[model samples]
Target: MRSERPFSVFVDEFDAFASPAFATFLNKGRSSDFMIHLAHQTLSDLNRVSPDFMGQIMGNMNVRYIFRQDSQPDLGKPAKTR
Candidate 1:
């Protein structure tokens, strides 16, 4: 069943938030009516601030879109993050 009132969260420039609790919303916000969207420049931005969070961050996101200036990486393979 889907809710008529859908909820969404969009976080732009995601690397600015350094707190662990802020990231936890990605995990906890998954109600049937909720959607989460995150945007950032690069994966390195995340790795620099919190190396441990990559696993947690990737776990919650079922859909991923990667865009680069020169060329897009081959995203044919499935993500294998724990």
Candidate 2:
């Protein structure tokens, strides 16, 4: 159910916030790991019971997908002299 167009647009729009949010969610709070673990467990349980449960959960959560793009120019193009 992945869409390249939406992922690309999301990454382009939210790349800046992604890293910060990930870092904060991973390291800033003592319960972050627990929250992630709980989410995984719930998803696993729901998946086992109903294949479409995860999609429903994500849709309810308003979750979005993103993809990283290499936007840098080729080095062979030559660097501007400072």
Global lDDT of each candidate: 0.68, 0.31
Q: Against the true structure, what is every candidate's RMSD? A: 4.3, 19.2
Top candidate, metric lDDT: 1
For residues 1-82, what per-residue lDDT tens digits would candidate 1 score against the true structure? 5778988878899888745786677776776678988887766566665777755677778888876533234233224563
The candidate that achieves the highest TM-score relative to the unseen native structure:
1
* Candidate 1, superposed: residue stretches over 4 Å from native: 1-4, 69-78
How does model 2 fare in lDDT? 0.31
Which clashing pairs does model 2 show?
none
> Tens-digit lDDT track for model 2 on 15-56?
223332343443432332232221231223334435554334
Q: Which ten residues in a row have the lowest lDDT in candidate 1?
A: 69-78
